[model samples]
Target: MKRAALVPEFTVPSPERLPDMWPGREVELDGLKAYVRDTPAAAPGAEPAVYVHGLGGSSTNWTDLAGVLAGRLDGQAIDLPGFGYSDPARSYSLAAMASHIVRWVEHSGRGPVHLFGNSMGGAAVVVAAALRPDLVRSLTLISPAMPFLDPRRSLQGPIVPLLLLPNAAKLAARRMSSMEPEALASMVIESCYADPTRYPEQRRLEAIEEARRRHLVPWYAEAYVGSLRGLVSSFLRAYLPGEGSMWKMAARIKAPTLVIAGRQDRLVDIRTAPQVARLIPDSRLMMLEGVGHVAQMEVPRTVARAVFGMLDELQEDKAGRAATQQVATQVRDGVRQRAPRVRMAS
Candidate 1:
């Protein structure tokens, strides 16, 4: 592919430089709003990458990573329906979300993309990839919520249902809002990290503020409940034996994959990393020490490096195989010519 010359640096007017709240144009569906960041490339076959964020997160969560990836490949960061700038559909389920993603990828003319997902989004991507392997070139999952039967350790096992209990989640949100910002932030920190103090105070405050703002919205509780129900139902379905779960889907995935996690993630224990690695045949695992649930957010460069390293390895392996095949073809042709001469003499 021909590369375009880099644009010269220049200052922009305030109006031009200002960020758009939704970042990109909205893809409207009945009763739902989907936001997308579409970066057009000057050349063809640039390879498209799509990123999906986790629960309680918006497309903005991937701002840093998306920028890095977009520079490397034509890419988009999507606000999954019911999260971030996206509004909820009448029926919010994992299947529905996955289906929406599939439609969006197809609609974008970027079917079969390099797919990236975090937490719950990771699970959704995994299911989607398994169901539509032809639409995925590769996968990168960060702290994916895989199904676990152990209730004591898994965060999704218990809290998911609680969040789905009709109006119960709204009541809890109301109560949570009443607490002091520092106290609420600390509570969230305790659940998300091994050591809350390791995280910067400003980042923690930002998280608290985001949560507070989300809670204040009237429809927030309904959205939360619907999403939680979908997550929990998917988790349960994935845990079942034989045919219908994530475990089954994991074994079906043919795409090269990278699974990343933080050793100190309190919500989803790091122990699940090896299991995920083992389940996905073509997958590699990377675990970072002293990090928490949001490893990419906490260490963007590190995450980017790990992801890019995997891509490099995959490329190298492909090139090596091609070279080996070429050499083998040459040797076979030489043997064929030699055999023809010997038969002529005979």
Candidate 2:
């Protein structure tokens, strides 16, 4: 059974958003440069929350959800290397991605943070949390791209074989260069959303603009294909019974976790949601209906509610533990006071 958490009493907060994606600046992480959008919390003294986007996604992917949770978390959504204006990295392996996250958190001096990841980012964070437990206080995974054997129905299935081709990135880049930004955006929307109409028209326009920028970048297709190859490698490791397995890494994660899966997600299978919950010792699971791979984008309010709910439960648990300790101390003190004179021969 999933570990139990207190039922929070609060209601889901109404979403707040800007006309466009939250503005951000580039930050240097050692030699790796990354772009991140910051969303300050509505309340003071809020804990830091770092968001990592999925393959092909940028920090903008978390814009809506980050705004919705701004009351509780000081959100920073990062654009991983080779995606979304971030400098390209030498490697696109899952381990490399996790290392980037680790380095960023360390560089920020923000250890023991609330870390959030989606799809490929989710798998990366799992490794990060496992690698350095002290760096993470909590984990929230949205439709994490866990390893799956049957890719026939998955969104990435058709492209699996393409990884074997020589100069795959160059080939893919050439093919993508021939397509318009609108077409690419439309393809992503159709592939990711359970209901295309739910996506805001303005956001659709933003996506197209983002796609146009991406097409102009030298590493756009390289990043996409390279990350895909890394993800598939991770999938292969999952089947092997060894220390390199992601399942093993996930099982080692010590932080309290929240796993959100979209029932209609075409990329990651919802059937694996239970497995994810089970593997992570202290975790809560939320399966959303009529939602696709990007639940945070499709239903920001609901995602925010679940996130806040987890925070509330953790807060209550802390309070309860403190109260219990206080009562125990008081009871011991009372006993000592009553029998103090006759105690201790020394």
**For every model shown, what is its TM-score relative to the native structure?**
0.79, 0.94
**Clash count, predicted structure 2:** 0
lDDT of 2: 0.88
What local distance difference test score does each model get? Answer: 0.71, 0.88
TM-score of predicted model 1?
Answer: 0.79
Which run of 10 residues does model 1 get worst, by summed lDDT? 1-10
Candidate 1 lDDT over 116-209, as tens digits, reads: 8888788889888988999998898888877665666655456655664567766766776678766766776676665667666556666677
lDDT tens digits, residue span 28-91, model 2: 8867678989988888878999999999999999989888788888988999999998999999
Candidate 2 lDDT trough over 10 residues, lowest sum: 1-10
Q: In terms of TM-score, which candidate is strongest? A: 2
